[model samples]
Target chain A: MSSGKHYAKGSPKPVLPDDGQLRLFSMRFCPYAHRAHLVLKAKKVPHHTVYINLSEKPEWLVDVSPLLKVPALQLSAEKGQPSLIESLIIAEYLDEKYPQNPLLPKDPLKKAQEKILLERFSGVSSAFYKIFLQSSGLDDFSLALDIFEQELAKRGTPFFGGDKPGYVDYMIWPWLERLPLVEFALKDYKFDAKRFAKIAKLIELLKADDVVKSFYVTPEQHIEFWKSRRAGNANYDLLA
Target chain B: MSSGKHYAKGSPKPVLPDDGQLRLFSMRFCPYAHRAHLVLKAKKVPHHTVYINLSEKPEWLVDVSPLLKVPALQLSAEKGQPSLIESLIIAEYLDEKYPQNPLLPKDPLKKAQEKILLERFSGVSSAFYKIFLQSSGLDDFSLALDIFEQELAKRGTPFFGGDKPGYVDYMIWPWLERLPLVEFALKDYKFDAKRFAKIAKLIELLKADDVVKSFYVTPEQHIEFWKSRRAGNANYDLLA
Candidate 1:
C-alpha cells in the first residue's frame, strides 16, 4: 500500500523501471482506489503503490493513464507502458491475470448476475455522491439500500458474492466504509440498522474480513478527510 | 431481428415460455440496443428480437429487466427469469457465453487496452448526446474524433480490434451511424473526413461489414427518426 505524501505537480518523478512488478497509482482517500486496494489485498497480488495529488496532477501520469485517473494499474514500470484505468476494469484485469482467489464467478450467467447487482449499486453511489456534494439524498440512499436488503434476503447469502466478500462486496465496500462519515455530515442522520438487517450484518462482516481490516479507515479519520476536502485544501497526506 | 411494431403500455403480454432460445428485448432506434444487435449478428448467435416502446414501456419488461432498459438479453423465455441489461455487460456476457467469433481478446492485458479505448470513446458519446438533444457539440465531437484518429494511427490496425470489427467497433458504430443525422440537424456542419481519415475509412469498413450491413440504417432514415424524436413522438417503427 502507498505510504508518505502524494506526488503532486513539480514533484520529482519517481523512477519506474521495467522491473516486472505491478504498481498502482492511487490516492489514500479515494474510494475507487480503495476498491483496487481491497482486490489486491484479497488476491495477495504483489504490487507497489504510488500516491498522486489529483488536484495538481503530474505530467508523467498521462503516459500511464490517458484519462489521468487514480487506481491505474501499471503492469510494468517501463515508461510509455500503458496502465489500466477504471476501478472495475482494473479489478477484473487483476482477477484475470492472477487467477487465484478469483474475484468474479467463472460461469458466464452467474458472473453477469454479480455484475447486474453492481449496476444496481450505482443508484446507491449516485445518492452517496449527492450527499457528499450537497448533504442531501438520504431518502434516495435509503431507497437504494432497500434494494440491496431485498437482494441480500433473496440470495440468502452471507456476502453478495456468496459465503465470501468477493467482487461485488469489495466494489461496494468503499462507499459503505464512508457512510458513517456521511452520517456525521448530515444533521440527525441515523441509519436504521433494523430495517436493513442483512446489509448491516454484511457491513459488520466486511469490517472483520482480513483484507478489509488491513486497508480499513476509521469513521473519525474519514470525517477528518472530509473536513479537509470541504475546507478546499484537501490534506491527501493526513495519514502519511 | 424483430419484424413487427414495439410492445407498449396496454399491449398484451407475450407468452414467454421456458424456451432455451435467447431473446433480446430491444428498441428499434436505440443506439445501446443497436450495439447488442451488431454483436449478435456478428457472432451468428441464434436469438429472437422483441422490440419495446421506450416512452410507454410494457409492464412485463420489469420481470425480464428490472431496470426496464433495452438490449436486455433474456437467456430463457420463462416468466420471472432475469434478463441482462446494459449494452456493454450484455455484449460481454454474449461473448463469454458463446466463446465463438470472440469479440474480446484472449490476453487479459490486450482486452484491457481495448476496453480502455472504449472508455476514451465516452467523450465522443457524450458529445453525440449533446448534438442529438440541442444540435450543438460539433466542436467537442470533432475533438473527441481526433483522439480516435490518433489511436487508430498509433495501432495501424484496420479496425480497433485489428483486421476485423469487434466489440469496440460495434459498440461505437451506433453513435457513428447517427452522426450523419446529427450533421443534418445542424445548420452548416461538414465532417472533415481528411482530418479523421483513418476513422472515416473505419466507418466505411464497418458499413460494409456483413453483420453491420444487415443492421444498417441510412442517414435519411435516421434524420426522420430524429425529427420524430424532436417532435416528442419517436418513430420506433420506422423500419417495421
Candidate 2:
C-alpha cells in the first residue's frame, strides 16, 4: 500500500486545490510525516495526505506551517483558521478527533506513563535523526539507544502497550522502522537484534503489520533517499 | 501559601521515611517542577512534595530519575515502581490520577490545541531558560516570546482557556512566573506589558489566585537564588 502521494524531485505539485476535508501536508519520505501516516492507519482515521516538495516548497505551505515542516493538518480552510503543526500533537489529535479505535488508554496514569515514554524516547529519535543529519554518532547517541532497548526488556511486554500495539507502540514505530537506514549508512552503528531482543521483536511485529506493510521501505531505499537529500535534491523513490 | 517541603541548602534529609502516598520530587526555583506544583494545586490533589537540592541531587533522586532530573513523582515505594519524570507528564498524571477537578479540557480538539501551544511555548521556555543560564540574549530567544505574546493576543482570551485557567495555563505559567527574573537579569530583555497585554493580565490574575499567591516568589528572591546557583551554591530562600 502506498503511504501517500509522492511529490518526487523535479515534479510539479498537484494543480487541483484542496477540497477541505481534513488534509495533511506531508512529504512521503519524511519520518515525521510517516508518524502521522502510522497514526492514521492505526486509528483508521479517514484523511488525505498531500506530499509536499520539500526542496521546492509551495508558497501556500509556508503560510500554513509556522516552521515549514511537514505533517501539518489544515484544520479548516476558513480565513484565520491556522493549520496545526507537530506530529505527536497531530497524532493525538487524530486519536481524539476520531474515537472509533482509540490508540490512547483512557486511564490517566497509563496515559501519563506513555507520555513519559514518548519524552524519554526523544533521545532515541534525536540520535536516529542526528546520525544521518549531522553525520556524527560517536557520542550522546549510543547511550540513548541503550536506554531504549533496556527499557523495552525491563517492561517485558512484547509491544510497549503489551499484547497489542497502543499509543506507545504507534508513537515510536515510525522511527524504529527507520533504524535500519541508520545502520546501513553508519558502518559502526549496527542494530544488534540479539542484544536488543524486545526491540527486535517489536520491530518484527511492526513490519508484519498490515499498515506498516503498506508503506514499508527497506534500508537501501531509505539510503537512496538520504543520498539525494544529502546531495541537495531529495524526493528520490526509495521504495520504487 | 506553601508550595511544598523544601530541602534547604546544607539542611539534613527528612527523617520521615517514605510512606506510599504520592510524593513529588521538586525544586522550588525550577519552572518545570513548578508546573507539577501548579497542577496539583489546581486539582486540589492530596500529595506531598519533597524539594530536592538540584546542586547536590541526593543519591536516591539519581537512582530513581533516569535523566537525574527533578519533578520525579514516586508513584509507589514498591521495588519496581519506576519514578515518573518530566513535569508535563507528572502534571497530566496528577490530573488523571486524582479526578476531583479536571485540569485538561474535556474536548479532544481543545486538548490538542493546548498541546500544540505547549510545543510552541517550548521556544519561549528555552529562550527564558537560556538567557539566564547562558547569560546571553542573542538569537531565537526573543522571537519565541514574541510569538507567544502574539498567539496570546490572537486567542483573545484573558487566559489561554477562556473563563478560567486550564491545562495550557498551568503548563506555561511556571515560566511566565519567572519572566520577571529574566527581565531583572537581562536589562535589555524586558517583558513589554503593553505589547503583551493578555499575558500581563494573565500574570496579574495568576498573582491574585489563591493557589498561585501561596507559591508566588518575588523577582528579587528569584534573582537572589539565581546569584547563588550562578555562583554554584543554590538553595536561596525564594519562599522566605
TM-score of each: 0.96, 0.89
The whole-model C-alpha lDDT of candidate 2 against the native structure comes to: 0.74
What are the candidates' interface root-mean-square deviations? 0.7, 1.5
Evaluated on chain B only, what is the TM-score of candidate 1? 0.95
The regions of model 2 sitting more than 4 angstroms off are A1-20, A76-82, A236-240, B1-20, B77-82, B236-240
For each candidate, report its DockQ versus the true two-chain complex: 0.84, 0.72
Cα lDDT of model 1 by residue, A197-229, tens digit: 999999999999999998889999998988988
Give per-residue CA lDDT, model 2, range A113-180, as digits (tens).
77887877788788777787776863566677677678778778887777778778877877787787
Q: Which TM-score value belongs to model 2? A: 0.89
Considering just chain B, what TM-score does every model have? 0.95, 0.86
Docking quality (DockQ) of candidate 1: 0.84
Per-residue accuracy of model 1 over B180-217 as CA lDDT, tens digit each = 87678676887788998999999999888999998889
- Looking at candidate 1 chain B, the ten consecutive residues that score lowest on lDDT are B75-84
- Measured with C-alpha atoms, the lDDT of residue B127 in candidate 2 is 72
